[model samples]
Target: MTRRVFLSIMTAAGVSLLAAMLLILGMLQSAYTQRYRQQLRDEAAYAAAGLETGGTAFLAALPAGSGRITLIGADGTVLYDSIGTQDMENHSGRQEVQQALASGTGESSRYSATMGERTYNYALRLEDGRVLRVSAADFTLPEVLRSLAKPLLLIAVIVVLLSLFLALKLTRSIVRPINQLDPEHPDKAEIYPELSPLLDRLSSQSGQIDEQIRELRRKQQEFAAITENMQEGFLILDRDTNLLSYNTSALRLLGADDAVLGQSVLGLNSGSSFRDAVERSIAGEHYQRTMHHDGRYYQLIANPVHQEDGIIGAVLIILDVTEKDQRENQRREFTANVSHELKTPLTSISGFAEIIMSGLARPEDITHFATNIYAEAQRLITLVGDIIKLSQMDENSIPVEKEPVDLREIADFACERLSQAAAKKHITMAVHGSRETVSGVHQILEEMVLNLCDNAIKYNVEGGRVDITVSRDPRGAVFLSVADTGIGIPQSDRERVFERFYRVDKSHSKEIGGTGLGLSIVKHGAAYHGATLSLESELDKGTVITMTF
Candidate 1:
């Protein structure tokens, strides 16, 4: 700024000096030209007087370099010439001579081809009816200015030096107080009066800036607090792909540190999909991708930030949706499993009925085929009912009418209901323990106990015993546990026992005559009652599922 101001001052001085010099030169040339012309007129009048008194002799008596003198006859013949050359042209057609002959005096200036210089001519009419003309080769404006070049150059150099010195001095004088001004209090500084308005504006702007900075800092802190604690990872990037903002969640998920800030985002994780998404977003396109990082799933979304010119930057939002994605996948698999399960029984029933209708079966086999068809139809009905129950539980669509439910009553009722099935399997079923009461939905509690007991008997060893225990522990918690000597769940399948349609023994599932939804139903019911369900099992030994309320 200082240098620019200095140069501007110097340039203005130079232009002013040049303009003044040109003006002075022009006026001097004009004045000198006027005086020179008048001098020529006076010299011509004096020679004309001399000529009238001394004739041709008086003309010869003039000084040597007095300039060319011509005396012309009344008939337009040059009779006397100061240079004494007879080769002179007739003066009758000359502008000054014609004017002198008509009006006694005339003057003009033109270049003389003979003298090879520009001349100012003055002609006076003599009393003898002849013209006396005096001409001198004088300097033209261009020639006069050329002759003054050395002096003018010296003057310009002096002016330039002076201008340079003043430019530096004045520049310092103008800028010193400004440089000394305290930015914190511009208005109170000692400065020129002409700069008061600027100082006042600066002071007002400084206050506003401080206020805005405080507000910005507050907002930034608030934003950091909110984003840093969020479960979802968040990130912001500049147009150059540098990390602008991020949170703790993002750093943990990306396996980065605070040092990664202001570094290229591509350096943090150079996955091809992430890079592609960033590129697309920077080009003004919205992009998203699902990435697997650190054994967890992340949904990365990139959205372009736009302005009037084009895309300026982008925003990247990373959401840790591992649980949500798992649930969605489970839902899809469940749907598929349901379809396959329902289709199997329906296909069997349809085939049997078609065989009967077409008379393809023998008469002796008709009853057996009819019984098989009926059993398959019943299996279909049971599968449909279980699906509806699971769906309702998932949607929480069943309204609960809560009450204190007696676990002993629910257990006894479940045992009695499964007695025939237990007897068919040669398994002994008994309810052993005092009554335990829990706050729950009655229907759901009964269903939970029945499913647990029924599963125990269905998957039990032939002649194995199924026991139901209901009691309160020392912690004042009511719990119901069903233990069975059955084909126990494998270690790998134990955790998945409560998941719908997840059967440990898929090959023998049909022979087991179970829908595989009983334990899943028990789990949902127990959860709805704020109960904790646990499983202890060993292959070929037994399994115990306990629900503590």
Candidate 2:
């Protein structure tokens, strides 16, 4: 804006100066030309005085611009002409001729209807009584104007070029110091004393602004660092919907892995709750809401970022509390499940004890009661062990070292171990194919494979077949499959099956004499090795569990 103002001022000043110079030059030329023409007219009049004797030889003595001399007799008949015999019949009506007849000398400046220019015409009547007339241009202005064309054009061009240079230099000088303030060397281009006060005011203002900016930057970095370090996501934007900034945490929380700055925000991070919060913040408001993404919950906040001018951008902070929330929920659910499990056994034990104390049970009955109590105690022990294992996995303190291992051997061993369990159900456990040694933690891999095979066998119908296949597929990655002809998992529960202590069939899990942490452990184990585990099953149909390494 300042540059534009400077350019406009320079242009106006330059044009005014050029116009004044040209006007002065034109007046000077006009005055000089008028004086020169008058001198020529006087010399012509003197020659006309010598031509009164009817001597045609007088034409030789005429001045320059007294081009064609004509002497008319007293009766208006042409007596002599320098060019040739007179073609016109008479010349008495000519202004110069009439003026000459009036006195010894007469002058007139008028447009010649015949010549098409204002000419200086003069004439005199000599003592011998013949009329002499002379004429010349009033100022010879045509020749002067033709001669001035080159120099005038040159001067105009020079003025325009000079104005352009001034516009460029002056505009830069004016606009530069605004956005780029020089604290170190403030006296660089001291413009003028009139502007000196403004500069001083600006200098003081800039000092204050610098301190403010330092504080702002410090706070911005603090917020930025927090956002970068957080596991949740964050974003900043303006009312124009242009992206201002985002942190690593915000990107992850928003699931925008490839977000770009200065672009529109709608392309990524288009989560509806997050978008609405940003819009509200742009109006200088703050809001917080819980939004769900990827089966998790996040608390998103939109805060207005302000400067000295006003609110500039909206800062968004996303915090992923899904893990913590889910943990609390799990804790509550576990307390309930444990209380329920314990209540049943405690009731039975109490009832049996009461029966014994009341003599309602004989010695054999007492032995049976003791056996039932011991079984229930073992169930509680298994359940407690499962809880500890689940907690250990949750801590994730142990890291795994992955390497190629013989999966065929591990699978064979696990099958043999669980073969008895399968046999009790009259189910067939079979190995479909063998695989090359794939890379993974030996212990985790073994546990995961064993758990899948065990689940497959345990869930199978009587006389059903359980097939385990291990091989390197076309993807060049090694995978293991455990399929079962069992009552398949329901679609709704399939997603929850990998959650800790989650069981599709609680009664069945209890009857099978196993902990519900098997699938959760397998999921964690797969995650530790960066392998993939997927399950596909339908109710009343078979199920397939695949692990790719």
What is the C-alpha lDDT profile of model 2 across 1-549, one tens digit per residue? 545755686678677976876677678767986776667566656565455453457676555455445566655667765545536567677766776777666667788654567777666676667676565556654666577789877876777677677778776776665546466445454464556777777677778888899999999899877867767566778767688777776666677777778997767766789778878888888899999999989987888888996988887777888988988997898788777766776787788788989998998888998888787778777667666655656676555556787888788888898988888889988886765787766877788889899888778888898988888878788888899999999988998888766788886666775656678878887787778999999777789998888
True lDDT of residue 509, candidate 2: 62
Please provide, for model 1 over 1-549, each residue's C-alpha lDDT reduced to its tens digit, 9 standing for 90 to 100: 556765786688778877887788788888988887788788888888888788889999999878789998777899998876568778898888999999998878899887788888888888879998888887576786688889878977886677677777888898899899999889789998999999999999999999999999999999999998897778788888888888888777767765467888887777787788788998889999998888888888999888898777888888888989988998998888889898899899999999999999999999999999999989989888888877777787777778988999999999899899898989999999998888888988888888898888878899999999999989999879999999898888888888889888888888887788888999888777789999999888899999999
lDDT against the true structure, per candidate, is 0.86, 0.75
Which residue runs does candidate 2 get wrong by more than 4 Å? 1-286, 292-298, 306-313, 319-331, 346-360, 398-406, 435-446, 473-476, 506-513
**Pairs clashing within candidate 1:** none
